[model samples]
Each structure stands twice: as structure tokens, then as C-alpha cells.
Target: MAKIKALKCKECGREYPVEPLHVCEFCFGPLEVEYDYDEIKKNISRDKIKKGPVSLWRYVDLLPVENPTVGLNAGFTPLVKAENLGKELGLNNLYIKDDSVNHPTLSFKDRVVAVALSKAKEFGFDTAACASTGNLANSVSALAASAGMNCYVFIPSNLETNKIIGSLVFNPVVVAVDGNYDDVNRLSSEVANEFGWAFVNINLRPFYSEGSKTLAFEVAEQLGWKTPDAVVAPLASGSLYTKIWKGFNEFKKVGILEENEKMPRMYGAQALGCSPIYKAFKEGRDWITPEKPDTIAKSIAIGNPADGPYAVKVTRESNGDMEVATNEEIIEGIKLLARTEGIFTETAGGTTIAVLKKFAEKGVFDKDEVVVAYITGNGYKTMEVLEGHLNKPIHIKPTLAEFKEKVVGQTINK
Candidate 1:
């Protein structure tokens, strides 16, 4: 096995032995798994990674699990050149990491859930559970079923129909809170402590979030071992943004890629209805207050993001700005991407596209730089958001005259 180290607090810097714990007892802040980089550098190499499976397991040396008991073919997704969307946005070089088609489940949540469940099994946990908005529930339920662990998922009652069925299909015990996500999450934390279930994003969070680093790992490697000039992704708990940055730095530290003068700019996108992070960033606040989330992009509608400050720090430190898109703009973004790239993104992905446009218009991206936007979830999961927005095809009599009349002077919406 590789050199197993300890978990360290991100706030007060206290360290603890590796376990299924997420908070530092001394400081009450979040904990993250830490490794001896010097040891990792000595053992990991290009050939070592190349010999592994074609999934996120390729970077197993840096992950938290000592033994991965169960997982799917997660990560190593395609980095597609968005020639059509790029031309529409007037960018010469642009790409899309479309994890909307990610395996084992549709959304990118599979990455984090896979890591969390593997760690849960490593710790000998019998049940896996979480407090989720949508996609995480689906991932936890399905992964728990595959791993033969009893599963329990808590969520708000207002979640999309498909999101509800997605988890229920796995036969997990699904609990719906009458209130919003924050309410359910608060209750879940208390329940997790009381019942000792392996709440993936809570108790096993320190290890679970390491899965997101693969987003950066794959991007850099797919770009011929170089990082892009910029990356735009939706912000929920803010962990994803920070993990992606950490992944690239880890690769550079281990000699898989040499440290260079260039680094990718990280942009965080949020919906206007639940944009506490963006509001805090604009107001120069150091801390964030949790809110009752209300937005079309329910998947990215985290009000009191656990990693909000860290996300802002990374964005500002990288010379990037955070922005929020209106509900209308989010819908337009969904249509824009669908029309140009044939990718039907949900509201969270729409928030990314909408923010990309806002920043692009503000000169945040150079037309020649390699820019990549992450599409995290499929729109089919929330098709209700687009229902009745388009006109039904006109039923014409069995006559060519009626068909020509309906088509005449009516230019295609495309």
C-alpha cells in the first residue's frame, strides 16, 4: 500500500489519524485528508498511472481509500472541442468537459460518491447515506446498492420528479423533509451523529471530495499534459472548485507534469435565487450565512456552502470573479447550448453557460486562450423546467397546401 497519513483541519490546522470523521474536535472546522507528498513523489509515475484502469482510479496514489471495494467507471470523460458554441461566443479556443454523461449515474456526483463509498467500506461501515439536493441522492442510492450497503437519503419534498425516482429506484430508504435542503441537511447531521451511518458528504467528506480532483487531472492530461487557461463550473458547496485546483497542483508536484508559470483561472457560477457566495464575494464579506434556497438550478442552490470562503479565496487569488445568472438567462443558456452543441444541460449547467457569457462579455476570457466549461448534469433530469416553453407542431390536413402555409415566412427557431 502507499504511504497512509493523517487528516488535517483546514481552519486551525489540527491533525488527526485517518478515520470516518469530518470535523476537527479542537477547532470545529472541516478536516481534509493529507498525505506525505515526498513519499508519493517517489512512487508515482506516468507508467504507474497508465497501467491503471481508464477511470479516476488512475490517480489512486493521491486518493483516500486504502482499498476500493466498489465503484463504477467514473471519470476520464471526454474533453470535447466546442467549435460551434465557441464560434457563437466568438472564442477561438473553447472546450467542454461534458460530465452530464458520466457513468453509473448521469451527473458528476458519481465521482464524489464513488470515493466516499470506497472510504466508507474501508472503514467497515454497513450503511451509506447523505443529505442531498438531487444528484448526490441518486449516486449514494445506486452506489450503496451496488456495494450491498443499506442506504438512507434525505432531501426536500420539492425535488424534481426524476431526481426522486432516480434514488428511489435503487431501493434506498428515502426521507423527504417538509422544508428546504438546509433544513433537511441540519436534521441529517444530527441523525448521522446519533445513528452513526456513513453520511458520504458529511462523515466521509474529507475523502469524498478528493474525487473532484480528477476533473482537473483529466483536463490537464487530455490537453496533452497542460492545464487550460481558464475553467468555469457551477458552485454548490464550493468543494469541487477547490479540489480541481488541488488536483492540478498535485500532478505538478509528483512530476507527472512540471510546474510552470501558467495556471488555470477558476470561475464560480451560481443562480440568482440562491447566490449567497456571489453576494458575499461582492460585499467583501469573510463569512457566509445560510439561506432558504429558491432557484431553477436546484442542484447548485446551496445557500450556506461549507467551502464558500475557500472558493472565494481561490477565485480571487486566481484573478477570477464570481457571477450569478438570472432564471431567464439560465433557461436561455440551456437552449443556447442545446442549439449549438447538441448538449441538453440542466439548470446548473445552464448557470455555467450563463455566467460564461456574462464574463466573456466583460473580457474575462481572451478569444485565443483555451477555455473549458463544465457541464455537470443532464437536462433530461429536470425536463419540467422547459415544459410548455415551445409551441406544439401544427397539425395540418392531409394536403400540401396547409403544410406550406404553416411553414411560409416562419423561419426556423434554430
Candidate 2:
């Protein structure tokens, strides 16, 4: 396998050899994967990609890993043209990249972890780990177990039971940290140093984030190798948004497809409970002010998102908008997308759908423009939250009179 060019710090542009590291020693800025794109371009072709598996592995040349991996069947998520939802939003061309149904674990994080673990293997690491709000832990454990690697998963102590079970099913060493996700992250950074494990999000992040680029790649490829006019996605740590933008730009740089028109307008969504990025964007602040998250969208409840500043800059540079929705609005948005399109998304997806609705209502979304909205996780992880909100029928002792009142010619359960 060809060697990766090197790792480069995003802020200071300092370079390091491929290693189990994440931060720059000089400026303390985040480090990211750097590659010899010219080499990748020479080897990558549409026909070559077509012969690969129907997963994100098809874009392995563009990803961080040099070898093929058989992790979760990540990527190549459905790109359904939302004609019905488009009409509802008074738009002509809208698409939903429904990652809610992605592979074994059923979340977009599987895509990233696939590449991260592959890198971990290349680096000769044995143990796999992550500090997750929810989905990342689930992906890490499942992928690690499959690779015959021991795993340690850390998460917020108050996570949803379904999410906890999702990771535990893979039988990892799960730790419920006694605080919010931020607290869990700090602990993981420390633990990563003490324990020589491949913590995917902390140590293997530069490569991990490359997995998200596939979402953007697949979207463009599925749309006949063309870039969309706009994209809307939920922003947590902002990695997804940034990687997506990188994917599209990389496509242009490679000349695999070329359109000299405007780059897509990148919109970001956030639950109002933790919307420091959106607030910073709106207020025209240079740095994001962190906040304590308190929302049902626990997946995206990062108080101090690592990529917050980059997210704001990317959104603004693309002539896009960032919007936040209340928790009530998020629930309604979840129901709306599910009711309209049969896509049962978690709260993070709800945030995207809510933002899409908001922007559409405000006439920000052009009817003629091609738009793609990413739904990152399934609602199954959050189904418990829906219980008791919508009621079960109260039986009159299961009597015939109950049917007459409740089921017979009922309108709105009259």
C-alpha cells in the first residue's frame, strides 16, 4: 500500500507522519489527514468505483485507508428523490439521503468508524474505543468486535437505554461517565494517553472524519455525478458538515466531474438547547461561545463542538444559513418527515428536517434548485421518547361499545 502523505494541523499547517495522534504539539490545533490527491486521482475512475462493493468502500481511494476493510456495511445509503416532500415544501427538486438505515448499527457513524478502524489496523493497534454521545460508541464497538479487537466505549451516563444497548450488544467495555458528553470527551482524551488503545474519535479522528466525505461523494454520484445546489444537515461536532464540503470540493479538484458554478449552499441545523454554532453564525462572532446542551437530540448535544468555528466559516463561505429549532419543533419535525416520507429519523435528523422546513417557509430554498438533506440516524434508538406522547386506545373492558366509539367511522379519534 502507498504511504499516506502525512498528517497536517488544520490551523498551523504543521505536518506529522501517520501516527496515533490528534492535536498539534505547537499550537494545540486539531490535526487532519493529508494525502497525495494526485496519486488518488490517477487511480480513481468511475468504472473502477462501479466494480467495488455497493458501500462507501467504493470510494476507498478518496478515504484515509489504503487497504479494503469489511466493517459494517457503511454508506451507499438511499438517496430518495423526495417528490412528495418537495411538493410539501413547495420545491421541485429535493432529496433525502436516508442514512437512518445504514448498515448493521443503523447510523451514519458506521461510515466513519469503518475507515478509522481500518487505519487502526494499519497502525497495528489492538483495542478500539471512542467517547460518544451515542451512535459513535455503537459503531466503534460493533466494528471493533468484528475485527477481533477489544473495545472500551465511553458515553454520557444518562444516555438513552436503546443507545446503550446498541453498543453493549457488541460486548464492549462500556463506561458510563458521570457527566455530559463534554465531560466524557475530556476523560477519553486522558484515558487514550494512559491506555494504548485506538480511540477512534480522539486518536483516529482525522481518518474517521474522512468517512463522512463519502456521504457527499455518494450524493453527488447518485445524482448522476453532479453536485447539488444546496445541502442541509445537522451540526454536532461539525465534522460531518466539514467533511461533506471537503468531499464535493475534492470531486471538483479531481476533475471527475466539473461544474464551475457556485459550490452548494451548506445549511446547518441545531436543536435550540445547544446552538452555539448557529448563534455565533447569526451574531457574526469570530469564535463560538459554548453552551450547556439540554435537548432530546442527545446525539447532537455537544456543548463545545470541536469544529464549531470551521462549521460557521464553511456555512458562511458557501453563502448558506444556520438555523436552530426548539425541542418541540424537533419532535414535530421528526413526526413530519416520518409521516411524509416514511423515514423514521432520530432527533438529529429532526433538527435537519426542521431547519429545511424553516428555510423553505422563509423562501430561502429555491424551488428549482437541487437540495439534499441528510438523515443520519434511525428513530429506533429514540423510540422510547415517543412513548406516552401519542396514546394507546383505552379499552372499555375490550367491549363492542368501545369499538363503536373508537374505531367506527372515527375522525381524529373522535
Candidate 3:
């Protein structure tokens, strides 16, 4: 009668009880939440989802939680049609699943933290913590504040100024490690073990990662109960990308989607500076080779992604591909989306858009195929990346003549 069956290892198929564990002792592989799809199929239906709350909790039956009490207002972000962006990309059906305005943190991290913290409360934890690149720190700090739990966030010392301030504003204990994300993660693991606190990405990762499936659930429900033809998402630890693949498949498995509907071709996007997954995919390898982080897209600059192999597996099995974009291309991608669709996204989203453009140019997507590009974080948190790239504001005297001569005149001259 339980909602979930057990925590099963992805490699050895070993199972453990529902607890704060993420690894299998037998194979040293990652563990995932196993559910009863037959029971879920009997309970979930289209009519039930339509009548549920507007947040991600609408798919609570699919997630790894019970009696959710955190992030009540999170999820249910807009799936914009993106007509202007679609025209520029030469694709007829392009949608932008914008999580830039996600509740509390303005990033998709809120989704995972929401589920993680809620489950942490259920497990009677008084503190919520995480190792973050940027957005996850903000999410944990803000959401933990809302849940009235003591919060600690660890991040690289060189993270963006705005992101640091974002977490500080929530009054959490923020630690800045003198290294990249992987290094910070190593230290956080030690801290989690010592403190016995609920490290969202460490001990509660199975529940945390399950939250990302809501993005796919919302996308399907918004698209009239159908899946997109293709999905291009930014990859960091690769959890989001792989979970989305799982989400769509789970929908089919639970009988939410029509029998004829198929999973989308999953495309993984990454910055050329830290593109381990991209390299692995290109080499046709089922494993990942770690790289050093050196890109403006810091949010997705994980040198050693924990879920890199699984992301590669999803892309291959779904007949998908991966691509990387240069720093210059990433900036242009941000500018293009802003100009075309009026969405200001961070470098991670920029990387995704740049790769989407490349795939469009290569004629990878059919003209009528429905493609969705996920914009995960708001650009305001990463404004420094666009400092010298964006056009400067024109200055003039406070007069109508000056406005016409400087602004209107320049526009007409062009």
C-alpha cells in the first residue's frame, strides 16, 4: 500500500528501503526510486490531472514524496509558443519551456529543492543543505527559509556575484570553496556525512532529481496530452536531461499519454569549455571523461557530471545527439532569444539555444517537428556574461530633438 516500492540500484538492480541513500553498496552505483506503475496507472488519469493544483504537485503520484508541504507554488511554468524564435530558427513549431521565472529562485533548481526539502521535513530534518553551481544554492537558501529550516549552501568561490547575493539575501550559511563545482561537491559530501544533515543533492538526490520530471509532465499536459518531437536541454550534472527522458517514458508507462505517442529525440547541450558529456557522445562511448570547468555558463559547468553516463544512455536510446557551443556562440544565443522572444536567460540556456540553432542549420529537425528548448535560469543572475557584449544605452540631452537625432535618427539610418 506504499506509494513507492523501494530504492533500486541502476547498475546491479539491488533494492533498499526508502531512506536518505543514493548509492548501492553492492555495485557502488547510483540508486533511483522505484515505483508501482500498475498501481499508479489505476489511480492517475487525464481528468484527474486537469482537476489538480496548477503546481508540479499535480503529478505527485509520479514523484517520490507523500503529503507534500513545500514549494506549494512552484512549477507550472509557462510553455511559450516562441513564434519569433521559431521563425529565426527556421522551425515551424518551437516552444520555450521557460523556468526563468520559477517561484522563489527564478530557476529550475526550485523544482528539485522543493521536492527535496519537503521530503526532508517528512524525514524530520531541521536543516536543508546542498552543493551548488549557482541556482541550486539560491533555491535551497530561499526554500529552506520558507520551510523555516536551517540552511547551508556550498559553492565555488568564483561564482557569479548576483548568485552569491541571491543566497545571502535569504540569510543562509553560505560557504565558498576555492575550486570548481566538482571540488565543492567533494567537500559537501564530507560535510553531509559529518553533520548528518539533509544534503539535498547528496543524501536526498533520488527524491531531488525526481522533481525535474514535473517539467516534462507540464510540457505534455500543456501540449494537449502529446509529447514534443524533440527536446534540447542544457546539461550539467546531466540529471535534468536524463530525468526528462524518464518523465516522458513514465507518462507512457502510466497510460497518461496516448498509445501512439512516442518519446522525443533528446538533445544534450553544453559549453565547449566543460563538455565531458558532449565528448563522450561524439566518441560513441558509454562513459564520461572529466574536464576542467572554464566557461561563462557556470551553471552548467560541472567537470565531472554524476549522471553523465545515464545522460549519454538516454540520448543514444532515444536516437538523440549532443552538441557544444563556444563562448561567443553562447552570448549570441542569449541575444538572439532576447531579441526574438523577449526572454533573458543565463549562459546555460544560451548554450542550449546555440546548439538548437546548430541543429536547425544542419537540418536535423523536420520543418513541422515540434521542438522545445528549456530556459532554466533567469539572465539577471548572470548579467556579467553580457556586460561587454550587449549594446550600450544611447545618451543624449533631455530634449525631443536630441531623442529624434540620437535614437530615432540612428534607427532610421540603419
For lDDT, the strongest prediction is 3
Question: On a 0 to 100 scale, what is the lDDT of residue 114 in model 1?
Answer: 88
C-alpha lDDT of residue 161 in model 3: 99
TM-score to native of every candidate shown: 0.96, 0.96, 0.99
Instruction: Supply the global lDDT for candidate 3.
Output: 0.94
Candidate 3 displacement at residue 216 in angstroms? 0.7
Model 2 bad stretches (over 4 Å) = 1-3, 259-261, 391-405, 411-414
Q: Please give, for residues 1-414, the per-residue lDDT of candidate 3 as tens digits.
A: 366999999999999999999989999899999999999999999999989988998999898889789898899999999999899889999999999999989999989999999999999999999999989999999999999999999999999999999999999999999999999999998988799799999999999999999999999999999999999999999999999999999999999999889899999999999999999999989889899989999999999998999999999999999999999999999999999999999999999999999999999999899999999999999999998897799999999999998999897859
lDDT against the true structure, per candidate, is: 0.88, 0.90, 0.94
TM-score, structure 1 vs. true: 0.96
Better of 1 and 3 by lDDT: 3
| True-structure Cα RMSD, model 2 | 1.8
Q: Please list the residue runs of candidate 1 whose C-alpha ends up more than 4 Å from where it truly belongs after superposition.
A: 396-414
Q: Note each model's CA RMSD in angstroms.
A: 1.8, 1.8, 0.9
Ranking by TM-score: 3, 2, 1
Ranking of candidates on lDDT, top first? 3, 2, 1
Clashing pairs in 1: none
After TM-score superposition, what is the CA distance of residue 213 in candidate 1 from its true location, in Å?
Answer: 0.6
Window of ten residues with lowest summed lDDT in model 2? 388-397
